[model samples]
Target chain A: MNNRNVILVIGAFVVHLLLQVLVFKDIVMFNVAFCFIYVGFLLLLPFEMNNMALVVIGFIAGITVDIFYDSLGIHASATVFMMFIRGQWVKLITPRGGYEVGAAPTIKAMGFQWFSGYVLPLLFLHQFVLFFVEASGFGLFFFTISKVLSSTIFTFIVLVLGQYLFYTKKASA
Target chain B: MRRLLLFLLRHRAFLLFLFLEIICGWLIVQNNSYQSATFFNSSNSIAANILSVSNDVTSYFSLRTENKDLAQEIARLQAKLDEKPKEVILVDSTTNIAEIDTLEESRYEFQTAEVINNSTRRFNNYLTIDKGSVDGVLPNMGVVGGGGVVGKIKYTSNHYSVVTSLLHADFYISSKVKDKINLCSTKWDHLDPSYASLLFVPKHINLQVGDTVVTSGFNSIYPEDVPIGVVSTVQIPEEATFFNAKIKLVNDFSRLSYVHIVQNLMRNEKDSLESLIQPENE
Candidate 1:
């Protein structure tokens, strides 16, 4: 990524973190579905970003949210785990002709089908680890599973809608 | 050695990931302990300021209900004041006797604070109040809303304090049924925000629905007889030794805007005296 792109990414990071803590923190539906829109920012990092940098960024983002949530390390651990797996997941599901260097994995850059395939599993894994870790064990097996599934769907829908609303479509390579 | 260095270099990202996770694990464990003051929480000055600003914007929407709740609380307190017996003073000029103090000294002092941020949907929830060390608010002080028990102060900074809400899964308060000698513990079931379960009530106690639960005063943290909740459900399995009961919490956590922190003046004395027995037992 260019210096300009790096600056823009940093700006987006701040925006996402603030919005998550301030606006989306209070937005819960049915007492189960939670909107973790910050995850969208992590998922949309430039495709050429190094794994090490991605993991570090994820830790920073998650820890920031954890502070506001008073949840300590649950979000950080979950986000770090997801970021570590993201590189391999992206390569495994690379579309025909592969991705353009420095391109972001957004719905606009990658079509809806490929984006869903790419983002859904990663989002699920993130939420799964987060809720389970917060719960501390399998004691609330069904309840935690329901929370994970509903939150994944809730976060996924908001993420897609947010991308469409705020993110401008980049021209095809 | 070169081959080992190359292997370590090749897996350096994974190693870093593991290291970060270990740090996170340590943080999680460290924060789980009660009354361990730490900085990364919402009670930190910057986070609390941001939350208070956001609350300033959104609290206007709830002004009507807030005013109504405050009015009701005032009316309740007024009724309690009127119920007290009137004091009579006798003049004895011939003896030149000094009058004894008629007013009873209260052990608990309360300070009002605004709730800047709160959450109920999370399994372990916390609240950030606008009061802190500057206001004499400290960790372990009991917090109560107009309706009933809110939480216990967990951490405090200069201008803000975080409360471990009653809705938190790990939080438990010593409590008992009103007008009964049997003591039980109230703890959140992590299912609903409005309800918490009462544990350790013996099966033969004959608990009924709608019984009021109040603080037991067994701990120095809270004053005795603070209303916690009203029993909503009561059940006992055939083989079980204790009754399984749930109480509908009096405080509506989602709409909580203001709380009073209960400071027990004699808490240090009580705690110190209790600590004296520990060494002999060991």
Candidate 2:
């Protein structure tokens, strides 16, 4: 809707791309870097961005990562669904339009506490659906659960780090 | 109606999220196997390239270890050669075998080849070797490395063939105990490639930890008596008929370079007769 929003979207997308190509791969010690790329779109959606658009972005983000990880559609689908819950996350955390003008609700924009609300629930949902779909549903119940919980923690930590690095507390508007 | 409209407006994101989740769920269901995506191609291709590069750098580093293993294998083979040679000449199995017969010796022809590409991490995994049909690497031949059975050949071109790693859920190898006292199927537990489980061995059998497990080679993908792994842990869940024996693999699939692809000289004759006996392949 505005210049700042476009920049955020474009900038986050670029960061997501670089993360996939250069980082978050093969270094299994952190394991959570597996889905950290999607956090770019997860953290940077514009304040006035439509929920449907965000979902689409999530889907796109998931699919893009899936393409490289060779995990197939597991990511695309998980991410789109993640985008779906983000609005309620914003509302629950900051209420109506709590974000400053032209500033996102990332860690830099809304501080750590504000971003945590967005991070935790969405991270849980994204990972749960992601792992569930990846396991083809309900087969190894404990495995799917462990994967979700571990991956959620990993995704959250990386997303927070990305937000700290990327988000800016500015009002171009 | 007005309440519904207000609810929809207030909770649009939740509603949409649910919808997208449903779509993802449906797509997952459509894929019968929880096939991790084709992202493997990109990562694997790059990784294969990186491995080739790293193989260049690390080959120099690992030459000592590789040479050490090779030296050990040579010593072992020399020791085996010192044993009294048993008389094992194959007669016509169908007609003359009824008269007088001792234990059939496992015939094996070894072909040396370099490991071109291999992967242990992915769901549906494949390994390629430099030697192929041109080098007498026919389909269904057994491949071994680091004193452990790696896998069987799936397909072959002139110079290369795809061998499915035993680490793959889709890959199953017929194997059992060395003494033929216990028979079980070997499988990767999907936890680690370095460890696999010997399924369907009943709890009734005496399976101690550190017992050697080898290829019984009944159906003959591999020669009888090739090493697989040692029993790491034995589990007897009360609800199951089979004892779950964990096997600590002897081969390090990650750092593989050279291997011995074994050719069964009598495979075709055995297979043709086998097809006539059973309607379905065991």
DockQ by candidate, in order = 0.87, 0.32
Model 1 per-residue lDDT tens digits across residues B1-282? 999999999999999899999989988998997567789999998889999999999999999999999999999999877865343234555676645453324778889999999999988999999998999988899999867899999999999999999988888899989886447899999999999999998977868998999999889778878899999989987899988889999988999999999998888988999999999999
User: Which window of ten consecutive residues has the lowest lDDT sum in model 2 chain A?
Assistant: A25-34
Largest TM-score belongs to which candidate?
Answer: 1
Give every collision pair in model 2. Answer: A62-A76, A63-A76, A70-B39, A70-B40, A71-B37, A72-B37
lDDT of each: 0.89, 0.67
**What is candidate 2's fraction of native contacts?**
0.45
* iRMS values for every prediction: 0.6, 4.9
For model 1 chain A, give the 10-residue run with minimal summed lDDT: A164-173
The number of the candidate with the highest DockQ is: 1
In candidate 1, clashing pairs total: 0
- For model 2, the stretches where C-alpha displacement exceeds 4 angstroms are A1-23, A29-37, A91-96, A136-144, A165-173, B1-144, B151-165, B168-171, B191-193, B202-206, B218-224, B235-241, B253-282
For all candidates, what are the clash counts? 0, 6
List the lowest-lDDT window of 10 residues for candidate 2 chain B: B34-43
By TM-score, how accurate is candidate 1?
A: 0.95
